[model samples]
Target: MDIRPTDRPDRRTFAIISHPDAGKTTLTEKLLLFGGAIRAAGEVKARGAARRARSDWMKIEQQRGISVTSSVMTFERDGLTFNLLDTPGHEDFSEDTYRTLTAVDSAVMVIDAARGIEAQTRKLFEVCRMRSVPIITFVNKVDREGREPFALLDEIADQLALDVSPMNWPIGMGGQFEGLYDLEHDRLMRPAADNARGFEGDVEQLGGMDDAKLATLISSQGLALLREEAELAQAGYAPFDDTAYRHGDLTPVYFGSALKDFGVAELIDALARFAPSPRPQPADPAPISPDDANVTGFIFKVQANMNPMHRDRVAFMRLCSGKFRRGMKLNQMGTGKAIAVHSPILFFAREREVADEAFPGDIIGIPNHGTLRVGDTLTDGPPVTITGLPNFAPEILRRVALKDPTKTKQLRKALDDLAEEGIIQVFYPSIGGQWIVGVVGQLQLEVLISRLEVEYKVDAVLEPSPWDTARWISAATPEELKAFTDLHRGALAEDRDGAPVFMARDTWELGYVSDRNRAIRFSATKERN
Candidate 1:
């Protein structure tokens, strides 16, 4: 509860991750609404979809109705500062989501009650599990017809391999829907009017589930079924374990319909109570603790043009140590230059306001021209590079063909900016004037084209590249690398950072080439050295 530079604050920095069409956007809207960051749900700039998540700010995301960019939002409730990171739900953006997960303390996994533990959900869960990031499951769409609560919980336990504990149980699901029984608080929450999407409007105070007044609201059959299921869920699943949950061994599940806003309030409270403050971050030489008496933060993401009017670039820095005051020059470890951040920002209603000061577990955007980069660490004390941030190998590769020759400079500028955002990779061939572009997924290409048309006013088409995939080439000595590059000059290219890369037609060819050159290493991932 202390607000000093050395004292730790009540911070809950977490992300919401789910598969596509799992009511992820709706849940985000309600969380912001309950946190009082937004005045109304309708306050989000609505386009054709009408209810897209405000975090889906990019034009391509709105058009495709799938979140591809990670959006960071900061808010507070009950004197606890909450940094809610909305990660990309689509599988194409899994790489971005993976990096975003590194910045959070925990994650809320949203599952469709009717369709439990989806493919994308499972993948994201594994990433969380790998880092020991705690998870809280929300079974969404309970108001609609869906699977039984017990079956859903079992599926999660089996698929995720984590102990399942029910924080709240649904009375009846789908058409038979009644409401949720607060297992922890021992109360009843009935459904609201048809127009309202949540259950906060009508709640009944009760001593416990066995209170005599329960018979007034429920039919005998429904009551019996509710009691039977609730009892089994409690007895069968693992009991709530904060220590296990934080260590990623157990998950506390809650049932609700984000569309109906059923259990969002409880979810927020769970985060405030159970979710952790800033934890020690992995770094070279040593790990950085939250209580360290130094300003330390890493740039996990960079946005090229968040505002169309200003056409500015903002580096999203997760405050990992010390309290940050505006105008303080922190050393950018990437270039050994001091960056005096004048306007650090927080997100709300799609607007930016200068952050005068920020503490650990807070995400503030530092606006800069181009001095900062993704994976760069800034600190006021001894410099240490943050670890685990890396660029992935692109699955889809192509050559850019400018539709108008006069716009060559514009296309180059556009590619550079988008590349810095980490959505795409630019490769300059050693022997040709044509530039190659690569991305982890196809949607990233669409986003690049859309941003170019809207933001940079350039037109281009993607043509098939000679290579199917590429790898970063490294050798024990410069002579070995040069000999390989000189022999395969036609297949050699340079990445955005000017790292040598060997382009291959396919995985089979890549293997053949690597086998032939025993001294060269073709790596799929390019990590910071």
Candidate 2:
């Protein structure tokens, strides 16, 4: 593959994270807009006031206003290329965030100035810290109601225990909100004057608050607000003493309403200026030796849609270390399948693909290559192993018993394929123990059901979820086992009604018996004729 350096593209990878409804998606949309990925910025709820998340693509996701999966995009600004990983803010998909965090270099923790630090924000911040990923906090929604920027900044520092320093402070929050006091520039950049299309004269000289407030700041408040234009003219960036707030060195805070397009250009500028790129760092670390080593990439995720014709996936991959070109003979790490690279390019969501050969530290997509799976490393020649991704066993469990037992075999095969694609588990427990399935969340379960009935032409029975034995366990008593067996036998004797009734009663009995220190053998129970 032929490759050329694009004028020192800053090797910075950043993930946008925050609690649900904290404007993470809004911030992402604004960033994408400024990066020229999308010509126009779309609202989260453009459909008759129904909020639509740009990153969320699932039907269930559009119906519900929450992000269930991670959406990644890449853009370039000022010769710096950024791999922007946008993650779900909900706690249910926290594992997804954890997995995506491994591929990124830094994080942009988007927080609502009004709501401050939330439970999910705290949990996610802890995850970033555990990985030692540097962060730049953006106090978003300054134009929203009940915002208190300073208070929220303090809360972030206290609650999340972050070394957060405000590089920009909001002039006034909520309705009266105008712009920010750029600590580095000492200029007040505010909202546009309604008619202004882009970054116009929205920013004006504030004269450093009123005289009374200035005196109050000096005597009672913390730092003195610089004396406007004169201060900005003197120092280009923040002072050397203000090394505490330099880009790349410390957490630089910015404020604006992403929805209103306020302070977005400045945010993009900050991202390009402050965020570090992937250059100079040992991008490819797979091969033990340097000489004659082929390029290797690690697959972080796989995206699949239901419609057969539109069955395309973008594998979020990191060039572990090696050079790869178009049509390169790439082999999966453990598999012998030699898959040819179609068009190697950086992916800005599925809609945007830039023509460029990806190198170390670059996140790109491999199209139409079905052989690669998550955690599989693809190399041009001999296999080289990199560190494995963090292991997260699926927690949510469910089961579906086929209604037409005649189609059980077909259902099992279809569900198995679904399981592989969905990163879920499907299995039949014993000879006729129904089918036990596992997924990451409830939405996934619904998708599985839909695929079964719609895609596979299998009419399946979704039985009520059984109580997890691990959660409610106790020693099994003979009497309890006998009661359970009696119930099961009665249900079997009664046929269809008997099975459901007996299954329900048996489940309850197991719970009661186990709670009272007893175990029942349900998996090996005899089927009464």
Candidate 3:
């Protein structure tokens, strides 16, 4: 068997998403441990001596114990390259997670067993459903007392409106938590001891439902319940359908306790076996194939400063097809100019290293300087634009000012870079000069301010703006756009990308503008042009 990264069949690129405090980060760490990417799993909230999660590399995340940005982690296990995108679970950072989802072929949804489906998880799931991205569900934190497995499954089915297939069944719960029974293979996996870590404490595997030891691990009543549920699940309550799963209609659910490191390996193994590889990406002329000979990829995310000391910018590109080699010349689809990729960087959270070559389904970062923007595609073949990246309207509007007037250039540069990363939207008044920053939530504004001070050594302040919502304006021709801009000059602005936007004080004002300017179209969400 050929074991190379270019072997597309062995590649698995997926994102892990969940609500805040759903143990998503913990699950990511355990997956890394099983993949041998890290020596030991790091706790999300380390007490006295334990270390923090490796994926949550930002200082703000460590202090707050919440992921504020998405991190890409690549690890090779069992001759497969698993590009795992660990996304922020906080609602404030949902935009970042949404963008990350566009780059993967599948998604692993981590749901809290006690909480079931959460607001943030549902929002992320909707995005996955929109893209037809296959989803694998993992109910985390089953070690503690929580909702019944059947109830949780039903809740997911009803709320998310998707078929739920139980791949494995939990033996017991809370204090009596023993292990899980694999429904696919009909085997019982019992942990040797409680609170085992890093695949420690030999896992006792019992084959055959009639095994005598099964009665000893689980009570007679508990055993009866497991048998009944397994039978119902296997009989047809939730049968695994590959076509349905690939079409985002079915989700294979697994029960696990990420904190104790149980069931993590099984989940990883299932992903390797079933997760889709780099699929055809939607592009301008048509969808691009991963098997295409020409190298192609798109910039889904951009980070202003990964290393606070260097003051650098990185444009994260997901290789869609063919192979990428350092120093190869590729055309920037946005500009239609040939550019050489000098330093192709690969990431493991905050840490990074230069890579010589990469293949489809792999994510490689290129050190950029105002050259790369989000949604910009690069290819060795014909120029084509990758579609489906949505830019949501900002909910909070504010006017920003730099404390030091002499650092105006630095401040403007910093804001431009941050805006490119989608942290905030920088808008300029129709009359020009003054800049306004708009964000989906307050946390985004906070992150922008923090990054300016930490990365660019510039202090900034934001004053609240009366406008509550923003929309990009589109028209049939340039004349119509100018006419509408002139008509609504006071409410008109230009986004960082130079797209015309209308700032409305309220929904009524927005409606008035739409009613007044019938020629112009107001879009709350705009896709990459």
Q: What's the TM-score of each model vs. the native?
A: 0.96, 0.72, 0.94
Looking at model 3, report the run of 10 residues with the lowest lDDT sum.
43-52
User: Which of 1 and 3 is ahead in lDDT?
Assistant: 1
Residue-wise C-alpha lDDT for candidate 2, range 330-416, written one tens digit per residue: 887666678777786665444444445765567777765355656666777675655535433344655687778899787866765
lDDT of 2: 0.59
Candidate order by decreasing TM-score? 1, 3, 2
Model 3 misplacement above 4 A: 1-7, 43-53, 192-201
Model 3 TM-score (2 dp) = 0.94
lDDT of each: 0.87, 0.59, 0.85
Candidate 3 on 1-529: residue-level lDDT in tens? 6444444887899999999999998899989878877767763322344344489877677878888999998888999999999998988888889999999999999999889998999999999998999999999887788888889999999999999999898866776666788877766666655345222544456775667887987679878878787777677656888989999999999998888877788899989988998899999998998888889999999997788777788999999988889999999986788889989998888777799999999999999787888888999997788998888898889988878889999988988988889888888888656688988877888788877887788998988676778999999999999888887798888887789999999999999889988999999898865
Candidate 1, residues 328-388, lDDT tens digits: the string is 9999996889988887888653566789998888889988887788889999999699998
Q: Which candidate, 1 or 2, has the higher lDDT?
A: 1
What's the lDDT of the predicted structure labeled candidate 3? 0.85
User: For every candidate structure, what is the RMSD over all alpha carbons to the true structure, in angstroms?
Assistant: 2.8, 9.8, 3.2
Q: Higher lDDT: candidate 2 or 3?
A: 3
